[model samples]
Target: MYTLAVCAEMVFRDRPVPERAERIHEAGFEVEIWGWTRHDLDALARTPAHFSSMTGYIRGTLTDEDGAAELLRTAEQSVRAAEQLSCPRLNLHGTGLDDKGLPVVPVAGEADGPNWIAAHRTLTRIAELGESAGVVFTLENLNTAVDHPGVPFARAADTLALVAAVDRPGLRMNLDLYHAQIGEGNLIELVRRAHGLGLIGEIQIADVPGRCEPGTGEISYPAIARVLADLGYDGTVAMEAWASGDDDLALERFRSAFTL
Candidate 1:
């Protein structure tokens, strides 16, 4: 069976980071670390559990030499943080526009331009960094139609394409179900295809339209869980969703729905 990881960032909003992390860990689910600072690290040291994944941006385009250099520094910091925490993977976002309208793809481009080669070079460098620290760098798919509009690599296919281009064993895809459902339906087939190619490093789940618990929306998580089991993916299935009433009740139903 796959392990369940909860996104404690959105949940446990009223509690301290360490307490929230411990709460999720106590619930028999893995915690996905939101931020790793000196304080968070100190807090995590006392917890009974560890994190399954970490997600954040490098804050610049890989297409530019300076931006890529800055990204390398950021990647190194992230890798060191992951190493210290014993978290094996650091999640990254694919290239696209920044808030300043810069071409968030690497190396060279006009604002909003797609620079595949530069992006590839940048990810490869980060993968090398991850390899040195015994960590994997995962690129996540996003929903351009709503949540992450204007990002060049928002679809499952887009993320897979970049992964192939990067051609690094230390780099893979975070197959985000909610984003795939929004960008292009047929998520089960997509997951199967990604798993077959050994491209999936993590699987993030939340219901479409509402981004809530599984049963509150149209997504058939039971069906998704069956595919995952058939594929023999005994990994973490992260519940990155919002709870409606009680978080405990929502989590219970999520486990029941996705129980393999």
Candidate 2:
């Protein structure tokens, strides 16, 4: 059976992050967070919630010299924070995102050959860092059409290719289906391909259009859940969505969708 979790940053808007984590733990699910630098790690550590993953770097881009150096520097810091929370996985992106979730350095189109080479070298160093730190680093896929435009390697296929090229145990794909559905269809096949390669570290979900809990929009999460089960994907499937209604009810809906 796959483990279930919720992104505390998206839900429980009324409480502090630690309090939200506690609430999620009490509600029978693990917790996920965004940037660790914004929260009190001591307070979060006191809570009983088991962390799934957190942002791996504070500031850096994957395809530049200065940005890659900053990325590695902050990644080491993130690894220490993960140790404080006992988080096993740290999430990364193609580049640093600003407060508004836009890329700090936006690319005009697909990454060129030089960009790809630089990104691979940076991720290879990141993999070494993860191996030394004893934590896995996941590269997440984002949709350029809607949420994160101008971000290089934002597509699931791009992320998969990068991770596979590195072919390191310390690096894996975050595999966000919400972005995949927006950027590319054929969700089932994507899941199969990623899982078949044994390169997925975690799976994130949200309904299309509204970005809310399951059953509130178009994606058939239950069917995807069944596919995951069929593939014996004994990993984490986290709800990185907002509550369309009450938070508890939204969590229940999320659980129900993946209950198989």
Candidate 3:
């Protein structure tokens, strides 16, 4: 019941998306795309037959008001692709503290409560639009220490609260274990708590320190895996680790770790 999403940047290895899709299928896994754009339409157009197997599409950003609306439109297009391809989910990143390289607001500390409210409002609007497009919108949490150093809402509790505030049936979260480890040490407990709140919709995993494959870090992924199975987490378990030059070796490393 687990699947992997290939980040276009890591899998770019000079191979095209269609080739990546073929490789993923050959590896006995369904495919989720990290990022796709209009420019990719040409490469994607050539593989209409393979598109129906996509698990989900991760949309990058939609900061401004119009940009958010445009993202909804894009999600519509992605949903068409997903339905044609039989994909189930669409992941999204929230707005940052600023747009156009200027600080308009912040969403981290108590002082930025109003800013966070505005940001979540934007997220709610986007989520509604996504529902209209027939795609589930899941927010991804980024670790400020490793990646996405700006803005706020780094903690899983806070992100869960944002999802709660949004309160849309289709709005959910893409919980990244690496970022959760860096931002919140008690990842399993947090996962359990989020599950109790019915917030987590999808999950991704990678070890911290180097963002390498699982078992490369201090996190007890086997225990975490047990927790996930017990929680009845039926969503895709994407291996969102960084490329270590050899994908086959990395996949084997992850498979061994998880299986053992």
Candidate 4:
């Protein structure tokens, strides 16, 4: 069965930070955090929770202006966070585009530029930095049409292409199923493809139609989990879903859904 890590930002929004960590272990799951601050880090230190992964915005897009430099800076900062928090991976977004598919951080008024080249250069540098520091960089695709509209690189195929181009052992893609179901179908095939190529670094689960816990929407998470298990996917598959009922109940339901 796939392992589960709870996104503190999504389900534990109302709880205190330290208690959030405790609640995750209480429910028998690892903890995943977002946008952590000094207070959050200090509070996290006192907990016995295992931080599986961390994700947030970096200064630049993967293909926008100052993209490579900003990604490098974020990589440097991520290593420090990883060392302290014990989370070895940093998942981040690409330089976003507009509705018409242009860069959010344009260079001289240009939006769309050479996609593969920019991704290769930016990710390669970040990979080099992270490789030495015992951290890894992951590129995640989000649904722009739904919850995360307007961001480019919101497709599983796009991330696959980036991983092929970058060709770094320390660089990979985060297959977020909720967003992929919204923006790209063929979830099982995509997972198979990524697994075959060794490009999937992590997996995030939530049902489509709504970013709530599994079984609340059209997606069948049991089938998805079985597919991963059949393929020998031993990586972390975190539940980044929002809570629709009691948080404990929701966590229990999620754990059961992904149970092998």
TM-score of each: 0.90, 0.99, 0.80, 0.90
lDDT of 1 by residue, 1-260 (tens): 78899888757778887888888888888888644542467667678777888853445556678877777777777777776667877887765345443335532212243567777888888878777777788888877667765565667887888887877888989888988999899999999898888888899999877888889888999999998999899777999888877888778888888886
- Candidate 4 lDDT score relative to the true structure: 0.77
lDDT of 1 at 159: 83
Residue pair clashes in candidate 4? 61-95, 62-95, 103-111, 144-148, 144-149
| Candidate 1 collision pairs | 62-106, 62-107, 63-106, 63-107, 64-106, 64-107
Better of 1 and 2 by TM-score: 2
Q: Give residue 254's lDDT in candidate 4 (0 to 100).
A: 89
Candidate 1 structure, TM-score to reference? 0.90
Give me the displacement of residue 41 in model 1, in angstroms: 1.6
Candidate with better lDDT, 1 vs 4: 1
Clashes of each: 6, 0, 1, 5
Mind giving the per-residue lDDT tens digits that candidate 3 earns over 1-260?
A: 44445443344357876676667556655556654542255555555323312323323233446545655666666677666555567766554233332223333543266656666777777677667766677777767665666545656666787888888867788787888899878988888887777787777778878887776778888888778778777666767776565776766666655552
Put the candidates in TM-score order, highest first: 2, 4, 1, 3
lDDT of each: 0.77, 0.97, 0.63, 0.77
Judged by lDDT against the true structure, how good is candidate 1?
A: 0.77
